[model samples]
Target: MQSNKTQQGGVLGVFPHYHWRATEQEVDMAMPAPAPRPLRLNAEPQNLVIDLRRTAIVVIDMQNDFCAPGGWVDHIGGNFAADRAAIEPLQALLPALREAQVPVVWVNWGNRPDLANMPPNQIHLYKNSGSGTGLGDPLPDGRGNVLEKGSWAAAIVDELAPLPGDILVDKHRISGFWDTPLDSILRNLGVKTILFAGCNTDQCVLHSLTDANFLGYGCVMLEDCCATSSPDFCTQATIWNVKKCFGFVTDSTTLLAALQAPPA
Candidate 1:
């Protein structure tokens, strides 16, 4: 290691012009930062031979409690805008996905008051839930079946409401794949890398992506397209967890670009 020093007023800055004498430690401190990695777009849509008829988009837990009026989460100091933004882009993308024959699965959690089928512990947790339960209903039309994780408010919202043909899968926990029909249904429909956008990024979304990865399917967490009970956890999960380990933490722009571009 060799180093040269320059003086600026009262401070010293290291220069590559090393004196004939220098130590390894001095050189290490002056090393340039690593180069930025290039952005990568997933190639699945290009690689697969099937037509647009093959892909399915799974939109998770966007129900009233998580996104709209009369939702219990709002009563508990939750931020609505944090989750609502997911709606605009998704709504904007719907027409294209629909015309392309990609199935849009709307999943919401709901439970019965008696907790008839759920465990006692879960039943206790959902005791006061008003939205996720059958109390108010998950889907606006009640056409597509709703999967109630309901001990109380596990339902998806009415804003980006479910359509008559949208498939609904139920779950009792955060990861939609945990003890649920999600994996089976996706496999049946031939969904590989699911383009997901929904509520509570730190928990459900993160859990779902981890499961999706372990299960061998690809996953991407749309960054600006998700929210949590707290903004901090939302950003942390999207930036650190999803970006570093679980999956690609991308955005709506990249998604729409991938959608419009011809399949690879």
Candidate 2:
């Protein structure tokens, strides 16, 4: 499938396709898992079976700039309505996932003031730091680890800070898998499937989803939980293209249904 999306007011474009697959030669490694999580559900004939013990929820960049009013976006000034719409849904989803005892990985972005300390820009030209901050911040629970992407600006947004016990996987590019231990962490946790939800659907979210598909991890995108600079077109394209290529499309309610089932 081919798609054309203009996000962040056409500043960011999203192109998603489904024709990619992981090769057999590349998936022979089994990464160790985090300690076994309590398994409370089984696969029903109609419902999906998830060994919660082997699943992970990756919450991407739900930061202050994107979610909170007048935080960081005031500077860049893209789409507040669009970003707000995205943050509201995940706010609800996180609690449900936590109740079900599923692992939630917070993907944060941040770097130093000097551009020289970062990976060379993927878009060709180097970009300057924006107030030295990422849009989000670590949730206060101490469970969330703050993964800084480009500069200090990359921490989890202050509005939806990660909780304690949360794992922080830092990166330098749009795709979280780039130069990050995220892949190994998921493998080690026996996480065969990934539940993806977060900010900027057009950028990091989209890239990560495609990469995840290439990595062969089952992806279930929580639709309402993620948003972009454009509330309508970009958001819609993200949901559509991601469903078409990277993984399945779903909402928080559907996810809860699958997770609440009795043991298999």
> What's the TM-score of every candidate structure?
0.66, 0.68
Which 10-residue span in candidate 2 carries the lowest summed lDDT? Answer: 11-20
Best by TM-score: 2
Q: Rate the local accuracy (lDDT) of all candidates.
A: 0.59, 0.61
> Where is model 2 more than 4 Å wrong at Cα?
1-48, 117-152, 261-264
Give the Cα error of residue 4 in candidate 1, in Å. 74
What tens-digit string does per-residue lDDT give for candidate 1 at 1-264? Answer: 111334333223332221122354443334342232222354322222223433467777787666764465554455766777778877777666676556787655655434465665554454455335433234443332233454234556555666765788876666788778888777655566676777777767777778888998767667766766665855674557655665566666765676677644
Best by lDDT: 2
lDDT of 2 by residue, 104-124 (tens): 898756543343445445323
Q: For model 1, what is the C-alpha lDDT against the true structure? A: 0.59
